[model samples]
Target: MVERVVATEEAIQLINKLKSIHGPLMFHQSGGCCDGSSPMCYQEGELKVGASDVLLGHIGGSPFYIAADQYAYWKHTQLIIDVVNGRGGMFSLEGPEGKRFLTRSRVFTEEERKELQL
Candidate 1:
């Protein structure tokens, strides 16, 4: 099965580190502006997921969601969560570590899109 969201090894390492300190975690892709454009990590229930949020999949056992409206613009692509050396969203967990979670994407191939029923 194809996953809509996946993380690189480095990202998985960071997630593990954060999880060790924060316990269970979850990720939300921001819509835009301020703390909305990047992927924000939270302590499970810290951020609420409403009917408008779509669960893309899990990365490092953490649920990853995208706003319904945001998913509309990104539906054709697959989300790749990565880690980089920099501050992430002001409110995201990784900000204090001097490293931020970054999101990269790739357009699904015709086969993948079909398999995903996209």
Candidate 2:
């Protein structure tokens, strides 16, 4: 099962907003540039949680779901999804702060930021 690190209030708010539009909030941690992980928001039908899937605690009372395939990578990972207020709905991730992994993906995009209302 995947564990949940302490999430910030901004992170919880973003999750709540995503959950309102979608059914639940789903993200995954996989091999990336650095020895760290990157969180990617998935659409409702994009996630495939199974019996072996881990049910991590909620963020701001919103259920955070992680797929079974991503459990191993997230075991010791610290994921913090925070919103950059007054920044055009931009969000930030703070954990290991590994520059390699953060740069691997365009984690934050103008369109995505606006969509999530970050």
Q: What is the TM-score of each candidate against the true structure?
A: 0.97, 0.42
- The regions of model 2 sitting more than 4 angstroms off are 1-3, 33-37, 49-56, 61-78, 84-118
lDDT of each: 0.93, 0.45
Please provide, for model 1 over 28-69, each residue's C-alpha lDDT reduced to its tens digit, 9 standing for 90 to 100: 996788788889999999998999999999999999999999
- Residue 6 displacement in candidate 1 (angstroms): 0.5
- Superposing all C-alpha atoms, what RMSD in Å does each candidate have to the true structure? 0.7, 13.6
Candidate 2 residues 1-118, lDDT tens each?
Answer: 3324445555666666666766655554433433323454555447565676565555555445555566455544444544443322012222212211121212434554455444
lDDT of 1: 0.93
- Number of colliding residue pairs in model 2: 0
Lowest-sum lDDT 10-residue window in model 2: 96-105
